[model samples]
Every structure is written in C-alpha cells, then in structure tokens.
Target: MLISNIEVIPGKRITDHLGLVQGSTVRAKHAGKDLMAGLKNIFGGELQGYTELLQESRQEAVDRMIVQAQAIGANAIINVRFSTSAIAAGASEILAYGTAVRLNDR
Candidate 1:
C-alpha cells in the first residue's frame, strides 16, 4: 500500500475514503540496555541501544496501522502522522495514524 505524509498522492485519485486508522505500542527500556546507555552517557556519546529501541517501536506502530488499513480494504494511507509520549519514567508510547483510502490511477 502507498503511504505518504502528504494529503494528496500525485497521479492517483482517491476513490473511496475508508476513514481514520491508528496503531500504537508501549515499550520500556531494558535493564541491560539501560545500563549500557548510562555508561555511554558518562562518555557523552550516542546511546545506540536507546536509539534502536525507539526506531523499532516506531516501525512496529506503523506496521500495525497498515494492517488496520488493509483490513478495511484501503489501498493507501494519506496524511500519515506519528507521535511519541512518555508513559512512565522508563517507558514510552508510540502512535501512528492516517486516513485510509482507496485509490485509482488518474
């Protein structure tokens, strides 16, 4: 399925609006990874572990959103958006949302 941040897709016409779809996930920092991140913080360098965690979380959220869209027979998703929030001291929630639509070649 085609996905984009823009409301309109070039060379494609929106044939049906399937409504809004969303997916989200919550994740916490692993103790081992957190310890490594803390050590890296002392050296004032990038926390690869934390970075990887967030990236993976984001992808999972997006994938879930796509599954929802597909289940509703949507061929594409437009105006895709992502949000992140701290759920707790060590946990964070990631969300992905978009308008599901059926498209046809113009």
Candidate 2:
C-alpha cells in the first residue's frame, strides 16, 4: 500500500475514505542502553540505542497501521503521521495514524 505524509496524493484521486486507521506500541528503555546513554549525555552525543529503538518501534507501528488499512479495503493511506507520548519513566508509546482510502490515477 502507498503511504504519504501529504494530505493528498498528486496525480491520484481518493475514491473512498475508509476513516481513521492507527497502531501503537509501547517500549521501555534497556538498563544497559540507558547507562550508555547517560554517559553519552555528558559528552552531548547522539543516543544510538534510543534512536534505534524508536526507529524499530516506528516501523512496527506503521506496519500494523497498514494491516488495519488492508482490513478496511484501502488501496493506500494518506496523511500518514506519527506521534509519541511518554508512558512511564523509561517507557514511551509510538503511534502511527492515517486516513485509509481507495485511490485511482487521475
């Protein structure tokens, strides 16, 4: 399925709006990674561990969102967006959402 951050797809017409589709995952920080991150913080460098975790979680959320879209018979997803919220001291939730739609070339 095609996914885009834009509200509308150029050269394509949305034939049907299947409503909102969303998926989310909550992840907690690993102790070892957190320790490493704390050390890196002193030097003000990138936190690779957290970055990787977020990337993986984001992809998972997107994948699940696609599954939801497919269940609704959507050919594509438009206005795709992501959001995150802190779930706990060391855990966070990642969410992917979009409008499920049937699209046709215009």
Candidate 3:
C-alpha cells in the first residue's frame, strides 16, 4: 500500500476514509551492544548498535501499522507519522500511525 507523510497522495483521489490506524513496538538494548556502544561513546561517533536497534523497531512498527490498515481494507495510508520514546532505562518504544483510506487507482 502507498504510505505518505502528507495528507494527500499525488495522482490518486481518496475514495473513502477508514479512520486512524496505529502500531507500536518496544525494544530493549542488548548488553553486548550496550557495552560496545559505551566503548564507542568514549571515541564519540555514531552508535551503530543503537542506530540498528531503532531502525529495526521503526520497521516493525510500520509493518504492523500496514497490517492493521490492510485488515481494515485500506488501499493506502496518509499522514503517516512516527514517534519514539525511552519507556525504560534500556528500552525504547516506537510507534507508527496514519489515517487509513481507500484511494482511486489513478
């Protein structure tokens, strides 16, 4: 399905609004990764481990949001948005949300 951060999808008309859909996931840091990240912190550079973790989390959240949209028979999702927060000391939560809509093919 087409997903966009904007309210409208170019070249397509919104036929129906299926309302809001959302998905979220929480991930915890791995001890080994934390150790490596800590070491990297000393040198002060990109934290690959944490970066990878957030990437994975974001993907999962988006995947889940897509599933929910599909289940509601939506052809696309508009105004897609993402949020992240530290829910715990070593854990982070990622959320994906959007307005589910049915769109004209062209």
Per-model lDDT: 0.95, 0.95, 0.93
> Tens digits of per-residue lDDT for model 3 on 1-106?
9899998888899999999999999999999999999899899999988888899889999999999999999989999999999989998899999999999967
Clashing pairs in 3: none
Error of 2 at 87 (Å): 1.3
* Order of quality (lDDT): 1, 2, 3
Error of 3 at 4 (Å): 0.6
At residue 81, give the lDDT of candidate 1: 95
Q: Model 3's lDDT to the true fold?
A: 0.93
Q: Write the per-residue lDDT of candidate 2 for residues 17-92, one digit (tens) a residue.
A: 9999999999999999999998998999789899999999999999999999999899999999899999799999
Off by over 4 Å in 3: none
lDDT for residue 79 in candidate 1, whole number 0-100: 100
TM-score of each: 0.96, 0.95, 0.96
Shift of residue 102 alpha carbon in model 2, Å: 0.5
Please give the lDDT score for candidate 1: 0.95
Judged by lDDT relative to the true structure, which candidate is superior, 2 or 3?
A: 2
